[model samples]
Every structure is written in structure tokens, then in C-alpha cells.
Target: MKKRRFWTRKQWCSGILLAFFLAAQTFVLSGCGNDPAATSQEESDNLVIATSFYPMYIMVLNVTQDIPGVEAVNVTGTVTGCLHDYQLTTNDLKKIHKAQILVVNGAHMESFLDQVIAQQPELKIVDASEGIELIEDNHHEKNAHIWVSISLAMEQVQNIADQLAATDPNNAQGYQSNAQNYIRKLEELKSEMHAQLDSLEDRNIVTFHEAFPYFAQEFGLNIVATVEREPGSEPVAAELKETIDIIRQSGVRAIFVEPQYSTKAAETIATETGAQVYTLDPAVTGPEEPEAYIEIMNRNLQVLLEALGS
Candidate 1:
């Protein structure tokens, strides 16, 4: 992030004279000397949207799918799981420079957003969680992973659609229609979740991370304790013992772990408590198909039913 030096008077005169030489050379060389990258940039499409991670990319894809020449690109390089305490790469800075607008699941999840804003001050941002209600602990700390719940995910998608429609008025109709179609699919899945999980006898479970609060609330599941209190960090020995004690006292049957992170801690807890560890999709990773959100949520519900339905 070093700044380039200002050109001196002589340097500017020489540089301008050299540019005049390049222009003469371009005409003489049948335009082959012209930078192709510059030509491509000039011919680039109207809108370029950059997503912070996988879920945002997929959700924004639904709205930007039918709009021709509108690009919805994921910020490339090593973005594993959520962007909590994540460090930005050189490639990510480059991508941010190219993007006119950025979309995010923004309840402080993208901790590096301030750096991005500093790098690209004029870049417009669309925070999907701007007006949506976040799940909070009794102490009032927010759980920003709203996409784990279909109902909340629908709201985030609606907010994204509204933002995009307002930003790009010509394609407003397409964005609105696409969001409605996707929300209908999510509503169907919510109904399915109710039918599958409503009758479970024992709803108590533990989590690998504290990611499933909103998800558990959505399905009426009681999360007794999360083995790993934070993402990418193992719980201390005291914390682990406490979680195991909670599992035993609460008679929790299952420990839900997400795919993006390791299950070693959850596995250890399960061994101590005789509770089974099951994988659940938090949807931090990309979906290969268009209906990937619904498909993965259905699979997550199936895992919950099998593990928690006593």
C-alpha cells in the first residue's frame, strides 16, 4: 500500500513525449502495440458486483442471473468459511478495485470491510443484513449468520434484491422477479423444515461452533452448548469440560459440526458424552447448482432430524 511518487517537471515532460511516441507507434504497428487489456476495459459491461464470500455470491447470483452484461464475481483467494477476523490478500484488493459495487452478509461478519473501503473509497456497498434482525445472546452480542435460517435468509435476499434494483434501475424488474421466485422456494423449504422437525421428541443438541443459534431458533431446537465457542479456535480444557457437562446434564443427543471447519473438537465431546456428531451445512461454501441453498438446507434438516429426533 505504498504511494507512488509525484512526477517532477522534467519527468512529466519526458513521459508526455514518450506517450506521443507510443501513439505514433500504435498507428504504425497496425494497432498491435495498443494494450489489449486497456481495450477490454473500455469494452467492459455496465455493472460489476463483487461478493464477499460464497453465500453472498450465490444469493446475488439469483438476482443477477438474467441480466445480460452484468457480472457477479466472488472475491477470489482463500476465503474459507466466514470472514470473521479474516485477512485480505493481494488478489482480493485487485478484485475490489475492479468491482463497482460489493454485496455482503454484513453484520460485522466481514471484519476487513473497513480496509476494503479504505482501498476503494468510491465503491458502493450493499449490506444484506442492514435492516434485518440479528439473533442476539441474552447479553446482547449479535450472531450475524442470518443465512443459516431460511426465514432470515429470505429477508436477506429480499434486501439484496431491493438494493440491486435501486442501484440498477434498468434491470429492476428482473431483480424483483428473481428474488420472488427464490423466496417462494425458501418458503417451501421452511414448510418442509416444520413438518420434519416439529414432531421430534428430544430437540436438545450441541454445536461445533456458535453458528446455529438462529438456525436452532428457526427449527425450535434447543442448543445446550457449543463445543467450540468460536470459529477456527478450539475451546480451552475448562470450556470443553463445561460443554461436556452441559451435554450430559441436558441429555443432548447430537453435536452439529459445519463442513468448512474441523470436527475434532466436536468428535472429542461426542466421545465423552456418548452423543453423535453430525455434519451440517452452514452454507458458507459455494453451491454448485442454482437451487443449492434449498438443497443444502434440506440436507441439514435431514441430518438434524436423524440426530435429534429421539
Candidate 2:
């Protein structure tokens, strides 16, 4: 469901942060720390680790795949798009009720996290964004798209692994080993991207929105502009015109469109500037198969490689 239209983004973010703090305080009061008995007891064959969305689901799944006592589930199942506009449903609450822990993307990405906390205050939370530096827009809002960068994604995975290890000390070694192996694979992918786009003449791109600041920063590319002031919202004409002007002035050759939102705004800019529009997967959701994160990222990288003429 949409937030109350009257509330500003800053208000929503502040509320979520307050909820997180209150939830955390309750968890501490419930005595979740240093209680080996409770920790081990919770690590049963049905150790339910519920993730906020697709990205968290995949990473948690990979961490718990080999451990017989653990299982990963998405609080919202098979989300076909980004969670920025998602509303929590009764079924979502039911899933949360069955979960022992909730894994969140945690840079204000899960706007509905407060509802889950309100429902289950003692629920363990594993914030994957913990300790990772974030990209902020001029408004100082965290970009909340850390997984787009391979290096940042590695940090998130390590954070998840560390959380799992601490929660389930019985499988701590396995969690740590699995995280290292996955991290190494991600490193290889990063190297591939660097090698492929290392010498491109056209490294400037425009996004539908600010989904790729971390990605661009990591890969040494310039984001000339973003077509939309907010993802999934109709563009304000002045904002669109400003972006179009940025594209025209920068001589940017491509504008990237994400799968979750309409390409109309990007198309408008491309039409105005004679730039090509290319589709890029943000890896927000994936098929039921394993390694979905790596697969989608590789696909996005290929799209970039082709656009950059590398």
C-alpha cells in the first residue's frame, strides 16, 4: 500500500529508523544475547530465515543451503519487481509470523520493515547493509542499492555470513567458509568487468533513476543524469528537461532502463538526445534456480560491456 500521500520521504525514513531502534531495544530486553541455549534451540531443522526481498533471499539461501538445520525464505515471495513501492499483505505477515529471523537490505530499502517489527518485536534481524558505506544523493538519502556493486555486494554477503555465524554458532565455520567462497567468485566477476570495460571510450550513462551510483562509482563510469526524480513516478517536466539537457551537454551515448519500471522517461530523454536506451536488470527478483544473483549481475555486465563497445 502507498504511504500516506501527505508524508514526506524524510518522515517515512525517520519512522522506519525509529521502529528499527525500538525493535532492537526490545530484542535486547528479551535477552537474545549470549544465550547459547536459546540460539542453539532456534537453529533447528526448520531454522526459518525470512528475507525482506529477492536480493536478501538469494544471499541468505546461499549461506544456509548446505546447513541442514537452516532454511531461507522470502517474507514476500517471488517479488517480480523492486520493493520500493511494495506494501505488506496479510500473507506477508503470516510468513513473518513463522520466521525466526528477518534479513533486511537495511539502508531504508524495506519501507514496510516497521510493520514487521510491530508485529514481531522479538524477531531477530540481520541487516546486510551493516557497516557498508552507502552512496547518498544531494538530498542525503542513502542510495539503498548496495548490491549493484560487486565490491559492495561482497561486503553485504560477508555481513550476512557474520550474522548467521553469530546466531548459529554450531554452523559458524560452515557459514564463514561458504561466504569466503562466494566472495571469491564475486571477485572473479568484478575482475571480468574491469577487464572487459577497462578501455572503453564511452563510459558515461544515464539511468532511469539513481539505482547505479555505487555501481558506476565501483566501475569507474560517469552517470550523466537520471531521467526520473523518483522511480515509478511520472517525471516532473522540469526535472525531465533538466536531465535531457544534461544528457545533451554530456554527449552521453546510452540511457539505461531497469526492468522494474517503465522506460517512457528514458525513451523521452533518448529521443531528445539521440541516445540509445538499453535495459539493465537490477537483480531485484529472479527465477527459483540457484546463483540467481550472479547470473543477473553477469547479464547486466554484458549489457554494459556491449554498450561501452568493449
Candidate 3:
């Protein structure tokens, strides 16, 4: 016969306590293996790229396409048009502060650049307009609208890719590959536009402002007159009369205005000169999509064909 043994209450309680302690130890070990500090370091390693405006944002988007741990954000968002007289907001400052790099059109396009550099001295800047020959604005200052020209825009993309690669050597190949892909598309568009625009006998044009000189130079269109020397400022009576006279004498049938500005001045000139008013986008502002620049430029080409093909 076998005698049955019963455990004491103290023994039972100690066994239960030991089991609980082992379970807690396992949980702590699992948590430690994950290492929250390591996760935070990985998050901080991601590159935050802040573009000064829309065009630069698009360029960065193309340059950084499909690159892991890279983000492109526009400081001025999608709605803001042109950085000519733009003022930075508090939210904008925060974005810039968090960014590891800032991509700008350069050529003095960013009026607040000096202030930004002063505030964030350690911030790396990639100027897209670097090394490209810039067209002069109405004021004789170098125009920052280099992206408006497809050829120059390709150059800017290459410049940005090169600078970004230099700044972030870890992602150098990604930047160069993406930039080359984008530049191929730009080259196709440039050839198509040149093929169409080169045959046009009527190359002289009248624009609303000084935004399109580089674009005109790319396609060999002559900008005989601009309605406004500067954006948001209407031409004076004498200046308006001079533009009308030039349009009349140049036999320019079209008066081009930007979608971002009021068409009143263009319309007034058109009414007096009997020229039709058309829209030409400078690609300063548009949809937030990466392909927005290409779409806008294609639309501009259609508008040019309609306005000038006659």
C-alpha cells in the first residue's frame, strides 16, 4: 500500500510566489529585448527634408522617390505661390527646425534665406538653382524661376541630386538614380515642346509679369513686353500704354497672365490691344502631387499652341 502525501500551505504559497516571479522576469526580459531607446534612435535617423516652396518640393520628391527613411515637406505647402515676398509663419519655422535639410530655388529667390541661415546655422541647404545660368528679371536681378524651363529644371534636378548625395552619402545612389529617371522625362518633355514651339512663326509674346523669361528663353519665344514689372503690382498708366503699344506693334495676338494673379491688368491691356488673354503657369503653385509640374507645363504648352499657333 502507498501512503498519499499532502503539501503544506506554506509550501504551496511559496511555489505560487516563485511561479509569479519567473513570469514577471520573463516579461521584463522580453521588454528589454525590444529596447525602446533603440526604436527612438531609428526614428531619429530618418531624414526630414523641408523644401522652401512648391517647385523645390516637387524636385525633392522626384529625387527622393521610394527612398526609405526620407520625407519631403513643403514649408509653404501647396497653396502658397512664389517666395518673392513670402513671410515665414510659426508653423513654417517649426517645420524648418525639425528638418535635417532645406532645399531652395536659390538665386535670391528665398528672400528670408539669410534669416533662416542665421536661426539654423547647422542646417544643410541644397540649392536647386546652383550653377544654372539665370535669366534677369525686369529689375535686372537674377530671376529665381529657373524651374520654369524644362532644360534648366533638369539641370536643377541634377544639382539637387548631387548636393543631396554629398550631404547624405548613405543615400547617394538613390538620389542620383531617381534624379536621372526624372530628368529623362523632363528631356522628353523638352524635346516635345521645342519641336512644337520652334516651328511657330509668331514667337513674340506678352506676359503678365517677369516670371516667364527663362521659360521663353528655353523655347526661343520672345517676350516683347510684360504687363507688370513685378507680381501683384499693376503697371502704371504709362507702362500699360507702353505694353499696349508694343503688343500692337509686335502684332502679338496673345496676352499671357498667371493663374495666381488677377487678370484685370492683362484684360485691360488685351481690351485696348485687341489681343486674347491666356494663362501660363509658372509652376510656383499647384496640386501637391509629384507630377504636378509636368502636368502644369503640358497644360501651358497646350495654351501656347492655342494662343500662338494661330
lDDT by residue (1-310, candidate 1, tens digit) is 9777799789999798657544533332342313334334432333668888878888888877766646687884335676677887888876776676799888888877787687667677988997887778877888888888888889989999999888666667888999999899889999989998899989887877778888888988888888777789989999989999998898888888888888898888889989898998888875545687888888888898788766
Q: Output the worst ten-in-a-row residue range by lDDT, candidate 3.
A: 27-36
Residue pairs in clash, model 1: none
lDDT of 3 at 39: 32
The window of 10 residues in a row where model 2 has the poorest summed lDDT is 36-45
lDDT of each: 0.79, 0.80, 0.83
Q: Which should have the higher TM-score, number 2 or number 3?
A: 3
Q: Across residues 38-135, which tens digit of lDDT does each residue of candidate 2 receive?
A: 44543332556899988888888777767654667788887757777789888988677666789999999987778768768768899999998888
- Which ranges in model 3 have alpha carbons more than 4 Å from their true place? 1-45, 137-139
For candidate 1, the clash count comes to 0
Q: Write the per-residue lDDT of candidate 3 for residues 192-252, one digit (tens) a residue.
A: 8988888998898998878888899889899999888878888889999999899888899
Q: Residue 107 of model 2: what lDDT?
A: 93
